[model samples]
Target: MASDSDRLRALKAFDNTKAGVKGLVDTGITTIPSIFHHPLPLHRLHADQEHHFTIPVIDLAAAMGATTTTTAPSERAELVATVKAAVETVGFFQVVNHGVPKAVMSEMLAALQGFHEETVEAKAPYYSRDSRRRVRYQSNFNLFRSPAATWHDTLFMETAPEPTPPEEIPPACRTIVPEYTRLVQQLGRTLLELLSEALGLHRGHLEEDAACLEGLAGHYYPSCPEPHLTLGTTAHSDPCFLTVVLQNAVGGLQVLVDGLQEDDKKKSDAVWVDVPVVAGALVVNVGDFLQLVSNGKFKSVEHRVVAKSVGPRVSVACFFRPQGAATSTRVLQPIVTNGEARYRSTTMAELVRRYRAKGLYGSSLLQHLSL
Candidate 1:
């Protein structure tokens, strides 16, 4: 058996290569590296049951009409209600006709795939372990700390509170990434407005007053030689206020949802349900920060992507949260209604710190924060 030091050495060797999982695949390796092997039992890793549950899909056109201005108050209210129910229950929903062009989404995915598939030399400049870099590429963000590595690479762009400088972006994704972030940011703000109204606050409460920022992560999951032994992404809930995901038709995203009857809330048991692919649709999910602010009125459900033997699967996620939380003194408190708060107040920095320490595939950060 490989000792701890041997495993650490293997991890460092992979990290030092700077080429991500795609690079490993490029080498025509027939088996996955030991570091990527998950310790999860076989039964859990290879569950054969089929899940029939489908997440709700919202038609933004029917809800918002041509514009927010033209939409009837009743229609807008209905949309808010739908948003409220989805967030409170599964914490996930899909939206279609949300204003971003299909061409742009396709271009963003293709550009990201192109960036990941480029020659190692071409992508080496953008590869780094420095979190300070607004734009950087890496095989795994939590490579050294996580229990096991996943079969993917990511190019992260800090696009919100401040847009990443165009020159810093990889050449393959330069134009489309910025354009995609801009559109996604607009959509995120609109979603925040709806959420604010759902929380019984004014429309501008979350977007303007709370001041949510945006970040983008383009994830490339290369085909795995041993898909059953690992994952594309381990189970984890987004630590931000919200996440908007754009995925291609080659889908493997799954959300862990309740298997028992809705009324049997006390006897909760989660089952992995596939998030069906809808052409031109974006997935929206509540995040830990949002759930914190809502005082548990909303949930931040666990979700993950499974590794596949098929070719590469790509996704772009836009996260809306606070900016510079680590240095800022701003405190995030629950939106108290009907008297009690379910969680104690904490800064985004502190919350994020706890999350980083706990890592993924463990109990949620919410447990420790609960009052």
Candidate 2:
């Protein structure tokens, strides 16, 4: 437990230093993981940890028609089966043949690295903890109600139809990422269709419900001089309907799976792999909202980012959320009813509000609401 005096001292120290003040200005906190009783050590994913994450490769080209025409029933059925299996078993998978080009991915990664490596002064203006803004740069989760701080610096940007203009994007990254976002938005729609089918619903069912979508680019810059003492991102699950993440060659992202010891966990061994850009291969996964809507039939799995000793790692995560203004408040029909009390209906706005209020805290917003 950290005493009030200890917290004050840390705050003073941070307030005194230029870097610390910069961090505070960007993150809106004097000292992160605030001094508290029983403040836990920062969570880190080590290779030795008894956790293994499964990596599934989903072929998106197979799910959608090569042309714009409707996919054949047999093809759709096969695609559904693959998605259902992947979601049920691993909860996280890699989608290849996803239509986003390799060139686009390469360019995006380069741009992100350029942005992070730029002078601290160049990146400082965007450094506010204001989530209301579509773009910002900061360290750790702004709503980090947790006791320990995550060890990473991040630049977050929201991209969708109603996107933050290119001018707002960091000068280094603006040009490369806009086109990437456009392609991803298209891919997101296609993946939603596959997820709907996997859930035993008609195509476009989920998309119709998710009338609009949002995308975020999480640029993870590792600790330079000392990387071992810190982490890139902490263990958590995506809060939206789906998250499409692109990882750089330097791989430290790991998904936690069932473990051996009473408290042991498993981690996947594969390095960074391409998330397919093909139609219907959006690497969809269950988010907290979807878990509630599906009554837990679909799972939102926990994932974490680990720091690398060699090079900085970057990943772009695009979240697809339901349109707050236009969509219905009720859960989709297929996820509920069926003569079973699997789940109760909840409004998207309420869920989003709760999630915003309680970033990555205990259990989940859905779990708390159910209680």
Candidate 3:
């Protein structure tokens, strides 16, 4: 067992540097430091043969495009069914023709990479843990509480309730993040509408019921010499209502299908399915808030990223939820057909507070809220 003093001492040392995992890697350490090693017993997960499974892919151009309001009923219904199926089974899917230009996506990624790959001295000023600061860089949100630190550093920006003042963001990263946020916020609204319909609710239900605040977090994973010792991200569900993640082609994402993990549950499913990189597609997942509101109807499964010999695994994720406590406080409306709320009504702020207070080592935010 790691002694409290030792862990605390190491944690503070790392945090004090504000350099994140990439900084440690720059030191050319051959072995992973104890802080990055998995705290529990390590189980080597089996990857299903590529041909054995496929992640659901949806093209939203026609269905969610400008013509959506006038789109043919059959076309819209088919799209809804497809999204609903993906959410029920895996809680995730890839979306193409989502209206965000490929050029925009590529440029945004390049910008993020440039920011993370810059010298430690250059990036240090933006590193912060203060929630009040909208644009900041940090290693792990729960670095102190988590059993081990993940092998990634991140740039986080809160863009929904209000975007970080342009002057506050790193000048080099300023342009892309705000623009990407606007684009994704629009895309996110369209997705929320689709989800509302998929849940058999009024089209505006989610947008109106859930607050529309959005947050974007860019994760930068550096190549690890001892890749097996640390993860890019640990297994956990998103705490928000919806999440859209954009990743570069250096694929390493894997979603957990509950029944597959022998330790997690029964053996109906047997392995993790690779989420392949499809050019110009965004990965979308139903989140904990959605699952809680839907009374367990929608899925919000755990997912993780593995460190690789590859140089960097860059992914930017947008999380959509209420803008503040006031909006988030509204009790979730029961499904009209079901007429019973599974979990007590709570605000997004409450859920988010619980999430921020706890680390990824315990039960999921959704599970913690279950009746």
Candidate with top TM-score is 1
Query: What TM-score does candidate 2 get on C-alpha atoms?
Result: 0.79
Q: What is the TM-score of each candidate against the true structure?
A: 0.94, 0.79, 0.92
Q: 1-371 in candidate 3: lDDT tens per residue? A: 67989999999999999888888888987788888888445524435663244689999965655574678888888888998988987898999999789999998899898888888888888898888777889999899888788889999888756677888877667888878888888888888888889988878888875546467788999888887777888878888888899999999998876444434344565356789999999999888888887788889888888888787899999888766555555665335356566666676677777888886667787665556
The lDDT of each candidate is 0.85, 0.62, 0.81
By TM-score, the better pick of 1 and 3 is 1
Candidate 2 — worst ten consecutive residues by lDDT sum? 270-279
Per-residue alpha-carbon lDDT of candidate 1 for residues 133-225, written as tens digits (9 for 90 to 100): 999899989999998899999999887567878888888998898788778777887888889989999878888534455578999998899
Model 1 scores worst on lDDT over the 10 consecutive residues at 42-51
Q: In model 2, how large is the Cα lDDT of residue 289? A: 61
Candidate 3 colliding pairs: 211-322, 328-347
Q: Root-mean-square deviation of each candidate, in angstroms?
A: 2.1, 5.8, 2.9
Question: Which model, 1 or 2, shows the larger lDDT?
Answer: 1
Residue 241 error for model 1, in Å?
A: 0.5
